[model samples]
Target: MGKKKTKTSSTETSRTVTTPTRPDWVDAQAKGLNDALTDLGRADPAASVAPLSDLERRASETAGGLGVGGGWGSGWGSGGTDWANWGRATPATGPAPAATAPDLSGARLEGRGEVPQAASVLDNLSAYMTPFRDQVLAAAMGDYDAEAGRRRAAQDLEMAGQGAFGGSGAALTRSLTEGELARGRNSRLAGLLDQMFAQGASLSAGDADRRQQASTAAAQLGQAREIEQAQLTQARDIERARLAHEGGLEAARLAQAAEAGRMQDALARAQLGQEGELARQRLGLDGAASRRADAETQARIGAQVRAAEQARLSASEQALARRIEMFSGLPLGLFQGSVTDSQGQRNGTETTSGATLGEIAQLVNSLTGSPLSRLFQKKGQA
Candidate 1:
């Protein structure tokens, strides 16, 4: 099999290859210095330092003097800023004196001052100025007697140089070993500083990766929460709809029950109406019976009136039959042999069957048309 070729992103390639980037410690240190300088610029515009190339000659001269001075905080002496080789402090033991008056006898005064021509002044003057000249001459030749003072001055100068080279902390060390380590790139300290600076840069990369991962995780969590909330809201809405449907069903069931109850009531009322109709029919039947009874009573009274009229007519006819037989000289029997006249006389056996129809008609009219029949008619009305 052939060796497989793989591809990688540009960012990974650069990291593995150790491409040039600012060291974290160095970058941090520079950022801090720039910030300080910016603050200084705000406070004092005129006094602000420019880049070395941009500096004026006067400022450059000032930097050189301060940086290379051999006294005070400088390398040649021990004191604050005021210490100098010739001007500020001269030792009392070696070459410095409190009072040394000038000579006037052998020297002539220039301009307007009068001369002092006294031998006594000249004799005492040697005692005062002799030390002064010797001190000046000895200093000029570098003949300092105190080895401690010379050593201190050299140490001070060396310390000040270290401050200038190592940069702005203005480091001044008491030990030669510390100064030596600070001055050059040496074995142990160099290795230690390199490892610390590399770790600092690596720590920055780790922190950046951690921050990116946290952002991605937060986004995912937010999406999950939105989905869960939507599902919950949908479930709640469904439950509400189901409850409303159940309520509607319950209402319908109640309405049906009420309608069935009404139907039952109507059935009961119809049965009662039938019972009432039957009762009315019974009453009508009783009233019809009463009317029939009334009619029967009236009929009976009519029949009795008819019989009484018949009896009255029959009795009157009977009396008439007896009188008719006597007048005809015949017996009142149904048949007789007689010859009869107006009076009661007989000649021979004869049958007088001939009666006057006119007379009988008259008699029946008188009886049938009597006040008694009229009274019966009035009873019929009642």
Candidate 2:
């Protein structure tokens, strides 16, 4: 079988990135700042720093005096008097008095009086009706009696005219006539009595109606009065309750105001204390900063003086070394010579004059084992 075709591919990718450069002025400014910092670093501290003003000098002197004379330095190390207690004390404020409540005992309402009694229409009814009935009956009976008397006189005259005055027939007729008249009179009298009684009864009934109307009016008036009294009492009670509530509210308001005033006073006192403490701490910090600045200034001045002295000493030593080197370069005379004798013999002898430059160089090279020893020896032989 044929092998499957295989293919391989390779991909390459490339990208170019461009970076933005700073402006010339920016670079110049940076370079200037760097050079300025370098020069400041190399400059003398004493020359760079300005002299203290009069105020600052006085402050420094005062601080120094306090440190030495007032035991301020010792106080810090030995836990003595602290600087925090150097201010005026705050005054204490008292609490406000409580409010008084109003009296409520006088607000109570009084009890109402007893209710009025109702009037009766039948009161003394019998006595008043009896009198009226008797008067009417008497007037009716008097009229009946007068009528009977007139009739009896007329009958007697008629009997005399008829000639029956003293006979049996006349007596019998007179008796019959008297009897009829008596019957008629009795019937009339009875009718008159009935009418009188009816009138009396009507009067009594009218009086009773009047009394009943009066009694009802009185009862109505009493009920109205009672209602009015009840309303008045309720109104008074409501007014009392309102007055009591208002008094309580006023008392509470006064108390709240007093409490608020006390709290405000307390807060003011606390704030005053905090301000005093902060002032003290600020003063201490400022004094410490002033002392530190003075010390640093003195140290800088001393360092500058020491550096100047060191530079002067180094220059003097360099000058002395140069003089020594110049003197040493000059030729000295200490050399040995050969003396001639008879029969061509030579002997060693010391020379009094100074040696030549080559001899001195050779002597120095031999002593020091210098690289120039060969040149000096060759020159001396030449």
Candidate 3:
């Protein structure tokens, strides 16, 4: 046999390539950050937020201009809405601020005045502002200290540059130069301290001014919001008054409509009942007529049956009469016979005989081949 050549499989011939790999933790962190960013990009804030319906929007519009800033409920009206409990006022937190009824004579709003928003803003200042002040102070101190450190480092570098490797005379001269430079640096550091102190004072004064400006702005904003709320409340009251007036007319119209609907329903029911009664009467009449016709047909059928039966009976009676007449024309004999036995008892028998032997033959012929006649004939033959 010739030598066989072996073929290598394609998978075995294929070379495996190795690539550079990153640390598992590094890859995992990068992947996680990428996934987080992707998810954030895809996320819809509106999906989480409930959307307002058209009706709700209308109600909100009717109540007040939407998105009016500040505490709308606090200054003018109540918290939440009155729609949940219609016709009722919100319960008061304290002894209900005595309401001053508006004077209709001038048509001017009552109790509406300039509210001090500055005082309100200043009231909460210490809680939030302390941290901000502390931060600013820290930043200024750090900057001052860093500048001082840089100056000190420069002085040390200068002294180091003046270092001598020569004899005592050179050392003394170097020492003199270093002493003067140290004095100058100390003077500069003192001036730097003074500058830092001045800067700190300026910062403090600026912060105070900023707080004052903020307070004034906040006060103005609050007053503006209060005015807006009062306007909304006034509009709401006007709308309520208008609706109240219309409500009375609506109630009367509804009452009339309800009464008319009830009357129409009653009329419809009466018509339906009348129609049902008519249908029932018609059905009853139709059924009675059908039954009467059926009864007449049955009576005619019964009469026909009776007539057929009477005719059959009459035919039978005539046939019997004709047979009787034939027998009457023939000579029929009544034979009386007596028999005596050895016991000395006498027996007598009576038999009716046909008038002719031909009649007797006819009767025998009619009974011929019957089971009882056959038996008698066999006996006679035997």
Candidate 4:
């Protein structure tokens, strides 16, 4: 008898894994965002302000000099002081000087001179007018007297020539002619006298009107002078009041500007401190997030490795079980057979039989027609 040999085999499987990568566009976008954040984090430069002009500088200096009691008045009426007197002028300790009337000596002199001249003109008017009237009357009467004398001479000659000068008719005509001539002379004298009187009255009335105009003009000139003086005094007072008010306003503006500057400085400091604290917090959060991401990645990788190892172990175990079952089903023992004698006679004859290797191979091939059997066949051939 010979011992049968048993064969053991094993198979190894290898797995391929592909790791995914980020696209080019995704990487570009992430780079751009990072650049933008960097730019935003940078500090800004300080801005510059324009210099003040000459007028502004002078105004500022003037305002600064107007401190408490420096000018205008004592302080701007702070605590316990009367607000009504903030920009008021100081009252006089004694009574103010009384306003005096404007000087009118020149006007008075002129008026005096005019009055005498008007009086003199009035006094001489009648003297000059009387002579002029006499001359006019003499000239007018001379022409009439010459014509009357010529007519009288002609009448005498005609009467004498006609020898009627000494007669009754001639005497009567002569008497009537003399009487008519006398009446004409009287009428002309009366008219000349009336015209002279009328002219004198008109001259006196004109002189009176001139005198009245001069007096009225003198009075109006004095009144205008007084009004001008009053206006000048009022203007000076108004100017003083305006200056005081402007000084007070300037002082108040300076105070308000100082307060505003202090508040702005405090606000800027607070903002800077807040920004620094926020930056620190952001750094801490970024670090924490990075650590958490790393931890998660490690956990995922470890789980994947563990799963792969378990699958490999299970496959190896299943292959080993199938090999064990196939080996158990094979008949490896030898068999012996004995032939019985006819008629139950005792005979000493026996037959022995056993399964060969080739028969065992055929039986195993028929029982397992799977890929595992082909794998074994290929290995055996190799």
Candidate 5:
């Protein structure tokens, strides 16, 4: 049989494992160092190269056949793992899901690209107790030592500090003069700041005086306004009292005027009533005059009756006298008898003087038979 062959490292053989990257602390630390070196290159490019080259060499030594990746690899979460099974539980009620079988097969055959990431090698190796002798391994001592790479990287970083100050002797002299000018400018700025502070103090004092005066004026104005308000209230009260008094006086005057008017109307009514009574008294006087006239007419009628009786008596006396003359050759005894008869007739007429109109006419007819007829006939003719 041939001798067993050892697996040569990436330094010796260029072959790399092409699988998903796993957690490897040594390789992560090397990469971190290289990335820091690249960042330094932006500031000073020449200073970064030496440290970067040594990092690459040490990375190859430690992580020889481990192919690395670009992104940060987090672990497979439970939520994504659950989705990878896909619709298995949903289809169990009926027939099995078609997607369920396919998803399961896919997960097994075409493996998901995921891995657990490790921390940096610096975090991993920091636990080791340190000494210069144990830190840098000699070339003959160990097959895997990043000691030489670490030393070269340190030397190159020292070189970078000097590299930041690159160009020459004449520039240094001008830089010194620039420093002096910068100091002179700072002194002038300090003087200006002092002057500004003094001006600010003066401004503050002026503002304080103005504020005090404004405060006093505001207080005085407030007091004056209060006085004016008090006076206005007093005036309003006085006006109200005056209006009330005037209203009472006006009401009294109206009442007195109304009473006077009533009194005048009553007097007029009384006078009118007295005039009506006077007119009634005049009417009563006319009635009295009519009664007197009636009484006078009655008295006149009585007088006419007496005259008629007297005339009848005289007619009887004349009749007796005529009879006596016819017996004139005779005696005094017949004359005496005639006188006695006439006297008797006169007493009878007197007794019948208050007789009614018909009775008086009847008496007159009996006494002067043809005489009253002739008289009535004669009056009618006349």
Candidate 6:
């Protein structure tokens, strides 16, 4: 058989096989260090520092975002949050429509195109006087004929008497005288006829003129009646036109009043709606304010808690570092034993353990008090 090969290995390792009995002093020191380490773990400095950086970054982002918004200084409000705008009244309805214009076409009046013509009064009067003038002329002619016949008979009788009484010279002279007398009588009768004819003609003309004047008056009366009738007709037409115009105006007024009333009603309703909306908006703003206040208070409380945790962590870390420094000076490897390797028939083992009184005292002092405290006030001091 080949020579048996032998290999050996030794390593330092901590293993718990069973619960160990510890001295009172050692237990106290161990408990102090464990408590300090546990506190350090619970209040890690990173917990405070990391959150602070995150908070600062978030605040910066919020402020920057607000600044970049378009409103600028004019848009700022009480808090960082944006404020709501006030409710506005509903836009006014378009202007009230114009009232319907009155229809006055029928109410307007127009004058007649042609004036009325009346018959000629002078022409009518002349026709009426003509018959009376002719009757007067005939009566004058008949009287002249009767006077001429009587004058001729008287002259004949005088001429016969002169002839019977005269055969001598004296009788001839008397005959000549009688002839002269007859001529004179004839001339006188002709003159009398002429005078009668002239008187008749003058009377006839006077009668004709008087009759013509009466006829003219009658015609004037008829024309006056026609004028009165025309005036009455015109008055009636004017009155009708006035009544129609008044009716149209009244209708327009009624329409205007109705439109005004409608507009007022609409305005009232709109105002009422606006008031209700404003109330709702105000209530919302108040609720937002309450929520904001609660959030700010919570933030302050959280910040205080974090600050306390950071302080505790700093104290705990310092205590843990002091404990490490104190234990490093102890000489636990001074108690030593050898290790053996087992090949076929041999087994190997190694062990080490030790403690120094000075190390124990240093640890005890570190736990109960500081090194400076032990040096300055050791046993008694005045």
Candidates' C-alpha lDDT: 0.42, 0.52, 0.47, 0.51, 0.41, 0.48
Q: Give candidate 2's error at residue 209 in angstroms.
A: 2.4
**Candidate 6 wrong stretches, greater than 4 Å:** 1-186, 265-382
Ranking 2 against 3 by TM-score, winner = 2
What tens digits encode model 5's per-residue C-alpha lDDT throughout 188-299?
5455545545555555556556666666666666666666666656665565466456545544554454445345434444444435545434433433443343334333
Q: Of 2 and 6, which scores higher on lDDT?
A: 2
| Model 2 per-residue lDDT at 65 | 49
RMSD of each: 86.1, 63.6, 54.3, 61.0, 86.8, 70.2
TM-score of each: 0.21, 0.33, 0.22, 0.28, 0.23, 0.25
- Candidate 4 — which pairs collide? none
Off by over 4 Å in 3: 1-170, 253-382
Candidate 3 local lDDT, 193-284, one digit each (tens): 56555655555656666767776776677677678767767865775465455544544553454445345434444444435555434433
Candidate closest to the true structure, highest lDDT: 2
Q: Point out the worst 10-residue segment of candidate 2 by lDDT.
A: 91-100
- Give the poorly placed runs of model 5, Cα more than 4 Å off: 1-170, 215-219, 233-237, 260-272, 275-382
lDDT tens digits by residue: candidate 2, 7-73 = 4444444444444443455456546556655765686756633354333343455456444433312
Model 6, span 1-382: residue lDDT tens: 2244456565554443433444466657767777877876777456535144222333344334432323312223334423232323221222212222223233222442233333343434444445544664456545655665675456456756766433465467566656765676566656655655556556656666766677677666666666766776666566556645653554465345445544543454445444554543444444344334333433443354345345544543565687778865654344233354433344555444455677766766676667765664565373
- Give the per-residue Cα lDDT of candidate 6 at 337: 34
A best-first ranking of the candidates according to their TM-score comes to: 2, 4, 6, 5, 3, 1
**CA lDDT of 296 in candidate 1?**
41
Candidate number achieving the greatest TM-score relative to the actual structure: 2
- TM-score of the candidate numbered 6? 0.25
Candidate 2 residues lying further than 4 Å off, grouped into runs, are: 1-147, 157-183, 263-382
